[model samples]
Target: MNEGDERALKVAVLGCGAVGSQVVRLLTEQRDDLAARVGAPVELVGVAVRRLDAPREVDVPAGLLTTDATELVSRGDVDVVVEVIGGIEPARSLILAALDNGASVVTANKALLAEDGPTLFEAAAKAERDLYYEAAVAGAIPILRPLRESLAGDRVTRVLGIVNGTTNFILDRMDTSGAGFSEALEEAQELGYAEADPTADVEGFDAAAKAAILASLAFHSRVTASDVHREGISEVTAADVASARDMGSVVKLLAICELRPGPDGQDQVAARVHPAMIPRSHPLASVHEAYNAVFVESEAAGQLMFYGPGAGGAPTASAVLGDLVTVARNRLDGTRGAGESAYADRAVQPMGETRTRYHVAIDVDDRAGVLAAVANAFADHDVSIQTVRQEGRGADAQLVVVSHSAPDSALSATVEQLREMDIVREVTSVMRVEGDAE
Candidate 1:
């Protein structure tokens, strides 16, 4: 090969699964356009998968497929490695090796990134290679790059999102049709929204992972999956949805990340994922069924939202290809992209220290004074009521109380006080209320 041909960038793909197949297809289909845009032709050196015999959607030469991911990434010819494998062990190890071998990396593994991103980012920084994962959080939404590049100069205060499609689909079905949780989940599974196992999506684990990544990027601090307070959609019953409708709201699985003040006057960040009651007027409430939306609040840019399909083979592949093009351009220019930020280095606050509003639904004896007793609990905890609705009097009365802005500690204490009252039969639901307009 001539010097010009030999210097062309070589790319290796790790994992040829659904998303990976689409990446390969796009690379081949859009080769001409991509070459023209990047100023140099990009070539696919090899693809690594667990089984070479497994059928693939993309047509590649047989010799280029390999079972050894380590060898493919460490190969001298590969200049960029795109990892689409969704796991922790070999993916992490292979990414580190690729960076060490003087190659940049782009991945779509949110689980691995949310768990051990800082470690891998540190390694990439040490090696001075670009590490991009635009596909990890909200697939095809272009959220990460906007926050990292476009809004880098602005001060971001909060990022609230409906990041998971499966949970959102199920919740939307329940709200619109009054379907039970199990029925909605079954329908989602039938339509491929919910996985067969469905633990990660329904239990809020997936949203929590995305929340940690967003909080870390928005606040310029380090936050992990363990730091997020998670509440899944499994416990969100039909009754809860009904209560939300009565109160002019809808239930959504929200991943909320905010930067607030700590006790010592320093910035404290809180990242949590839970099923919350969003007002009907909120923009996110209008987002329905398998669609994702992220609302960002910044000092300079003001309020901005990015909305689109959060997951799927084609959507995720679009993000990966975009990153691949950017990485290739950076490589041709002999430059590295921005690494992870530890700018503010703010501490992550405990859940109890975060302040918000709550909606508490209680089943009490059909008596006049029961409402007074519930109001007293709020007053005792120093949580003022924003709205109160009581209905179905006689034997089984239900009272719904929505609180004004209150400390997380006070909300918890108020719940405890209501639970201990003699007139209160049971606390049907206690959900956090968010996205109140400033």
Candidate 2:
């Protein structure tokens, strides 16, 4: 074995489930190549695991597995710590310890970042170490780097993405197979697209976390998971999917982040995750299965689309490795890569102030005056109706209305007013419309 001119950089990977095992393989198998890229051979110092005897996808080298995560980060010899642990407490404490101990940290923990990213960034900054999390959102799409670096000069106006693979798979199943929500979810669980306890994915918590991250990067704001207005796809019915199809659209769960001027003239961020209808011809509507795609709109870049495999052990590991190499190179060069750039620090706008179009389906009396009354209801709320499609007649009649872009509050108020109308029997569905020009 030839000793490279540059000293080897020791890497500690915390957690050894699916992604961890792959990280170990890449670090070992690609050592020579990675060494060339980083100008230093990157060695896997140890892997922190709960159980040393658990089965793994890749073989761990001798004497590399340990149960002491705290001690691993605090070893004081590690140069880069890669954290794949997904939660808040232990992951947060370990990452803080790693940065505090003079080690650059690379993490794919979206939850920790979205919940308390600024704290981690501050710690890394105080320690003058690099912190990169390209794998936290959109898996291997490389969206974060583009937002945080490539488009750093440009003003990013919006980031619309299908960030969650589980919901995307279920929605794609509902559209393609004409299956209902429950049946589609069951199939997703069976196929490993969704987990047995999939509340995080299906209920929009996962997408919201990703949304917070995207909003922060795209708008240079401090957006957290709690700041996001979340509406899950659990309320997405088969009828909603059918309605989308009828309008030459498709139903998909979307994480939308926008930067618009606030009342006092400073740019504000509006971040939300929900099920929305997108036109079939749109780029995002075509993203199917468990794949993820982010459509970024910026002033200088115009329009850019990032599409690829979003999740699974391998693809996500690929993103983790990308960050690892960059951080490793920085480590070897005695310099540091970019940390969080929340320098802009724009305000996060509430959901009611966000402007968007809406698709509303109402069951109303088929008799005269109902249509006029509903139109009046929309007008009263300052909501402009874009298109109206009527179905059946009399008691079984349905009035499908798509509204022009308006303040979300106005749309909600209009729906509430419609619900109180004597002629309106039921509000079958009310969904935000996206990916189509009004």
Candidate 3:
């Protein structure tokens, strides 16, 4: 091999799936540009797959393809290992081994990172290697680096984002087409935005994983996937969309992470992923289809947003390549990148401690004083209604009240009081309203 190729940083791609193929394709196609940028050529040393006989997309040599992922990761020739085989199993194990064997790592597996980030990060730190995963969250949007580097000196108070393209596409279609949940999901699957078994995407699991990562980075604390309270878009109906539209708003799945004061005068972080009502004028409401946007509210920077394609082979590959370049530079310099933040390891506040506005739809007796009674219930709990709308007069009337920012305890008490009222039939929906006009 030539001196340029010999000294080039060698990368092994584990899992030649949809995302892995793109990584290989880019490394080959953009070799000249990447080499110029890095001041040295980067080479793809090997490609690992579950099946050696699987049809491939890239023009990689068959000899370079192998089913031995463990062997590939531990090879001494591999300088950096990119793990795209998502999940908690062999991906996690292989990543740990890659770092143990003195190789840097770039991963697109959000699930693995969300679950075992602390362990893996510690492993890399011990090895004095870089473990970068910008592709793991908000694909191609360049979120993690900004949170880790650009905004590292600033204090971020809140991060509310539309991080999942699949659910965002489904919700956007439902709002515009007035389609029910199932119909919108069906269309999303057909259009390749969602998988056939889309439980992970539609059920808010995917967004929750991203939320955990964002929360941890923004707060400089450790937040796990289990710490987030997740609610899916499965229950959103056409009626819900119409209700939001009537109020000049739209429905979107939001991953929200905020650091607020607790009772002890200390900072407490709250992380959650759920479907909520966002005003039509909000920036995120305009984000449609398989795109991602993260709105950050910082104490110093005020309001800022990062938006782009959140997923896809090329978009994801772009993020991986960026990390690869940075890590390669750090490796050559004999220095490691920034490690996890152990500063301000604040408590993850319970869901009940998270205070926000609420929109409640209740089926009430269409009588004259029913509205007054409902309003009194909210007043009893010290929750003030920002707006109230009553529809369908007579015995089948429904009372919809949107409350201003209030304590979660008070909101829960108001709901309980409404449930106890004899005139109230059922609570149709009770959703949090975020991104209110400031």
Best by TM-score: 2
lDDT of 1: 0.91
lDDT string for model 3 (232-312, tens) is: 999888888899999999999999999978989899999999889999999999999999999998988899999999999
What lDDT does candidate 2 reach at residue 193? 90
Write the residue-wise lDDT of candidate 1 on 390-438 in tens digits. Answer: 8787777888889998789999999998999999889999999987732
Clashing pairs in 1: none
Query: How well does model 3 score by local distance difference test?
Result: 0.90
- Residue 320 CA displacement from its true place in model 1, Å: 0.5
Residue 352, candidate 3: Cα error in Å is 0.5
360-411 per-residue lDDT for model 2 (tens digits): 9999988988899999999998998999989998778999999999999999
* Cα lDDT over the full model 2: 0.92
Q: Rate the local accuracy (lDDT) of all candidates.
A: 0.91, 0.92, 0.90
Ranking by TM-score: 2, 1, 3
Q: Show where candidate 1 strays beyond 4 Å.
A: 1-6
TM values, all candidates: 0.97, 0.98, 0.97
Q: Looking at candidate 3, what is the lDDT of residue 87?
A: 95
